[model samples]
Target: MTILFHDTISDSHFPSTSHPEHPSRVQTAWKHLDGLGLTNACKKGIASPASLEQIARVHTDGTIKRAQETCARGGGYLDADTPVEPRSLSAALWGAGTGIAAVDQVLTGNDRNAFCLIRPPGHHATRSQSMGFCLFNNIAVAAQHAIDHHELRRVLIVDWDVHHGNGTQDIFYGDDRVLFFSMHRHPFYPGSGLSSETGTGDGLGYTVNLPIDVQRTGDEILSQFKQRLDRSAQAFEPELVLISAGFDAHHRDPIGGLRIDEEHFRHFLDFVLDVGDEYAGGKVVSMLEGGYNVGVLAECVADHVQGLLQRSLKTGSLKD
Candidate 1:
């Protein structure tokens, strides 16, 4: 259950410190992890910028060119909510590249799993459009890399970002090679996670969504999460597990209304790790997606890393 992260992930930044998706998100977490010595405890890898070919797998050439050209012109908003800067393109590249590296590392047995601590929270970026403060879909890129580069036949993506992982869902909607699951707040930002929105064609039923339309206690949320996750993981029998780990679901978050907290996330991790142990050989790659409260996000990151470490010591891997 060795956890791997790239140090260069901290280089990602936005213009406004007040922005929810600012560099301090990672910087604060890195400092907290460092204070606990988990920064050194976890394996550190270099985060190289992603190649255009890799980006092409999940993004359109137009999308790539748009990001490139916009940043070249001193940066602008890709959408009303998403902003960019001179270095945002570089950040987006490294962020996606970190996901690729994490997939490669975990799949090749170099590490048991990895936590991509990069920013510009990605699950919101569609193939042709970047929105909701997301530049490129990092988790989607990682899952695709696993399917194409690693030759994995079945991959499972679990996104618990409070907001629907609409872009990731769209990219893999018709592909059976990847199974996408999202437990999100319905009628929320970008608003596209409905229980009825299952995958189409070859990917029918592969897209599982739990649209939380009402507020539920953390305990109740965990109960629903456990049942659904257990059944899906058992049936799918995925070769690898990728997580869109967003702490914005925490009750402390200003933008979200969910009552989930740190313990619930740990419980979420425990369940996912159990699924990984049985179906994916403990091969899980997690990427940062969305979390507004930097303090709570940092704490959740620490607990997640500790959970991986402790689980490894207790059960030889990340299982409940």
Candidate 2:
């Protein structure tokens, strides 16, 4: 497994103290990855900014222009929660590019699976707008890249963010090529992802939403995730797997109330890797979405990367 990141991800900052999504989050995760020796165990690469043409596959030209223009004009609030700085546009481009790069690395056999430690966390940005501190839909862009560039027919996207990935769901709601699955806290921020909100038209059964309760423990969430993936894998038979890996659901996070911890994240990774092995040639691309508490974010991310490394070694998929 290889880890893709860039210093600009942590260099992009919001001006307010109240914002929980800050650059320190990535810095903390990197610190723990180094402390735990995961960094040394895996390949490391710097991320490059995604081109406008690549981003245009999943986002509207107007939205792309708006984001860049907003940052150019001294930066302002795109929404109540999503603020932009001078460096935000560059950060978002790199963030989205990282996801594309991870996909390229895995599918090209450069790595078995890759984790993108990036920010200006996506999955919340819609085709026409940016919200919830997300500027562009990074996972969506990567999934599209896999299909267009790799000629993949089926892609599976699993979002475990505490909040629903409404933007991702909306982007692929009518496309059967991508199976979008999300498990999130109900009655929470962005207030979407109802179980009944399946896909429309050809994508009817492809969109799966498991709206978990706020008090549910990590075990409960894991069980639900496993069951859903097992059932979906039978029908979808994903050619590739993409994970919107968010650790904000951890018990210690102030923004979310779920009881997941570091150990649970490892277990989750193991399960996902097993699923990938079964259906997707063990190809997985995971992107960092949300994990606010800097204190524990690194631990969770390290556990995830360690799981990827262990799985690669076990399967003899590690690249030289």
Candidate 3:
């Protein structure tokens, strides 16, 4: 369990007034992982600045430059929700860098998998805009990294965030090489993952969005997601898998209505690991995107990592 992150990703870099997407989110996760004795297992990775082309791999150049300049200009808002302070771009870029590091680590077998714990979630950032407290699409960039660098023909992104990963879907909307699946609260922020949006052109039927209704329990969510996961992986046979693991759907989260406990969240991770074992050669990378409640976020992330390691140990690759 090599957790990828850097102090550069701290709130000091991306100063904010009182935003929930602050760096404390990662801090909370670290506290819990440490309490669980998992911190020692983490192999810290440095998050270097990503090149314009690296970002352009998944985002439009105009959007990239604009975000860069917007952060450069000191302060502004991508929307009423996403705010940028002076250090916002560098901090946000660090988020993307965290994902990039995790992707490279997993692909090169530095670890069975890696969890990138960084702030300012990225699932809501689209190809051309940032929204829902997200700037750059961290998971999307990592998925593209797998496709381009690994020459992977098929890649699957499983977003379990309470909100739909609209940006991820939009990035691969019509691409056959990538399959995007999201289980989220419908009619929520950025609201575009209706079941009918299931891909287009060369990617028709490749995108699957399970817009679960509000008030759904984690157990119920996982059951439905399992069907989609089982079917989609068999159909796509992806060479790599990425997760947009957001804890905002947790029962205690102030935002969404999904009521999921730590056990259920761990179950979801186990389900993901099952799929990775079957089709991806145990290649899976996860990047944090959401989770505001410090207590719940910490516990949920710890449980998720514990589950991943448990499965790996069970399979004889990862030592407990």
- Best-fitting candidate, measured by lDDT? 2
Give lDDT: candidate 3, residue 101.
74
Give lDDT for model 1: 0.84
* lDDT tens per residue, model 2, 91-149: 88888988888888888865778888888889999888899999999999999999999
Per-model TM-score versus the true fold: 0.96, 0.96, 0.94
Segments in model 2 whose C-alpha atoms lie over 4 Å from true places: 318-320
Candidate 3 lDDT by residue in tens digits, 1-320: 55546453456445465777777778778887878877666666666766668788888888877777777888888878888877877777777877777778777763677777776788888898888898889888888877888788898899999899999998899899999989888888776889999988999988999998876767777789888889988988878889999988887898874867777777778888888888987877888878878888888888877776665556654332
Q: State the lDDT at 185 in candidate 1.
A: 83
Per model, state how many residue pairs clash.
Answer: 0, 0, 0
Worst 10 residues of 2 by lDDT: 1-10
Global CA lDDT of candidate 2, please? 0.86
Instruction: Write the residue-wise lDDT of candidate 1 on 1-320 in tens digits.
Output: 56656555446557566676777778898889899988777777656778989989999998889888988898888888887877888888888898998888777754577788888878988888888988899999988999888899999999999999999998999999998989988788887888999999999989999988656788888899889888888889999999999989998887775989899999999899888878988888888888888899999989988877665555653333
User: Candidate 1 or 3, higher TM-score?
Assistant: 1
Candidate rank order under lDDT = 2, 1, 3
lDDT of 2 at 87: 82
Clashes of 2: 0
Clashing pairs in 2: none
How far is each candidate from the true structure, as Cα RMSD in Å? Answer: 2.1, 1.6, 2.0
